[model samples]
Target: MTMELGLLKALLNKDFYEKNRGLRCPPEIFSKDVRKIKDCLDLAMEKYKADLTTEDLQAVFHATNKTMTTATKVSYDDLFRKMQSTKAIHGEIAEDALSSLFQQYVGEQVAQMGFSFVNGEEESLEPLRRLLDDYKNDFTPSIRVDWDDISIETLMAANKQESQWKFNIPSLRKKIEGVSGGHLIMVGARPNTGKTSFHASLIAGPDGFAHQGAKCIVLCNEESYERVGARYLSAATNMTMDEVHSNVSLAAERYDTVKQNVRIKDSTNKNLSWVEAVVKHEKPDIVILDMGDKFSSKTSDKTDVYLKDASIYARNIAKQYKCAVIWMSQLSAAAEGKVFLDQSMMEGSKTGKAAESDLMVLISKNPQVEGADEQDTQRHLNIAKNKLKGGWHGVLHCDLDGDRSLYTS
Candidate 1:
């Protein structure tokens, strides 16, 4: 749209006029008809020590042209009416108008220079050099952003995990303060490190997320839904198969409590997009991806690139669905036999996967001494990365009952 009127109205503001008037813009910048009005404003700006107004400019215009005919006066009055109706474009918008005008002027000057050269009226490139030198430092960007609130009230509300879904594991809860909706938690471990059981414990064990009223969906690719569901059953009932068979009624009752809220899906060969679709359709409060790496199809690029894309997708799903996505991954062999683990030990992956995680817990256990055949129940939850409560990072000890898919502090 035509910014002529807007520019004039913007100049009425003292600060804008002072900042921009240093350009020493001539009447040539305005259209032929509006040049007269611009000249009058320039006169009024100098004459009025306080502030210039449309009425003041009108008085200046009429006073300067006392011998104008009636028709000419009417045309000028219509132009003033147009300018008056136009709302002032101040701040960034006014700056943009001025910049655009300056650019337009520069373009016309360059074009005239080229025309002069073509007609053999110019000799060297000195005119262009002078033009660039004169206007080189004229353009500048002044950006100001109103940041987000840092008030105690807002921080407490935003970082509050008290009202969120609490972790069933006591030791973990004290460290991470539990997880809220729209959180992407990455859990990595080597094979047979109770990776599946860890999620099962947090989600199906007593006072677990499901019992706490979080609608959860487990999409397993590494294992069958029936197998994963069985783990959930054991976790919910806090019983081994032998114990459950001996007391089916008690196990059934306990499992029945959290069964309705918990859902298990056999999502073999499914990608992150499929997971998103299921989450969007079911609208669950929590989603679990068994072996999250399998969700991404192998591509021509490096493993990290596609895995990074997958992790990004998973995070986006959690945020968009407003639910927590628990991504189970396998840690590399380098992390094996180590009591402490970091995000770097994630198998077939790099920082891209870890970077997307809110809380990264890599499971570790006591190394085998070769001769001893005792099963180690002790597990160390390596808090490799924590972007939650207080942002603390450390390890916490917990015992795992693999048979029942449970973890306890």
Candidate 2:
């Protein structure tokens, strides 16, 4: 093979691994030494600073060599030579391998059914069509659907786990189970309707997922890290921002506890792909996007199309990571002064409203009037859409403390 197992091992040993972070290592190349080499590489990287010293490389080589009985010990010189050569021809080798595989497939197909046919005829084009389908299937990676028998005991155990993941809101939690794994919960509200505060409550409130020991990550695009942190501290400590700022030591102590379970990222200018990457790395139980409209789209499509695609991406990320994703969005101008808000009131795209979310919530301040009292505002949580139990919708009322940036049931 042009890309050998030894080459991959050598590349991952030290300096090469950092330089070739984007390199694709084929699993087939390391049939025997894959685990050993990976472990050694991980250890080497963890122990070393930047480049692996001579002693570090030797230690890894000896560890891997000791695990093998039949395989010959690889000399450092030989390994370095192989790595250098592989680096030069890696791209060419991959291209050539794919081309050869395609050619071989065509040859086999032609041999099985003789290629003595007219051009563009159904019989002549059948093999090509099959080839294209096979290629597409091979290249497109997807989550595997396992067809296996499940015991009642297994089902009950899974149910117990699912039951633990619930929304922080009391009425919503009672009406609907918490935001379970692979679910997208969309929160929409009119401007200045305390959408950000509601989400913060879900992360730092006493009944929140984070407070329940679930690892949480919040991506804030519109707000600064300092502002988000202050809000979280205010919510967690039951103190206003002004109080938290004045009592720095007490706020810091409370924040230290909050930081143990939750992570906040400044996601300014970050796209859905960046969010996916963060999810993959952190593997948090819950992910909160402060504002869905801030997420950059993958395509140069229109706003609606971009929103649709972005929502799908968020949903897929939730499923792939087995986490709950709470995405915040804004309501259109038409929703202003309206007592009740539905999916149609969602700004920008209906696809986000119609398809992406597993649960949709609309927030509106009580009275729905201009110049509402910031301190006395009673925020109403409207369950506009709930996929968990069809035909189940209700409204939950909470007191919004503007000073602490908290919403309480």
Pick the TM-score winner. 1
Task: Quantify all predictions' global Cα lDDT against the true fold.
Answer: 0.85, 0.71
| Candidate 1 Cα errors over 4 Å, as ranges | 1-7, 15-43, 46-52, 64-73, 85-146, 240-252, 273-285, 297-300, 312-322, 368-375, 390-392
Query: Can you write out model 2's per-residue Cα lDDT over 276-362, one digit (the tens) per residue?
Result: 999999999989898877885747557777788888889999989999888999899988877677888889886654588888889
Which stretch of 10 consecutive residues in model 1 shows the poorest summed lDDT?
135-144
TM-score on alpha carbons, each prediction: 0.75, 0.65
TM-score, cand. 1 vs. native = 0.75
lDDT for 337 (candidate 1): 94
Candidate 1 lDDT over 320-373, as tens digits, reads 889999999998989989998988899878798998998898999999888887
Candidate 2 Cα RMSD after full superposition onto the native fold (Å): 15.5
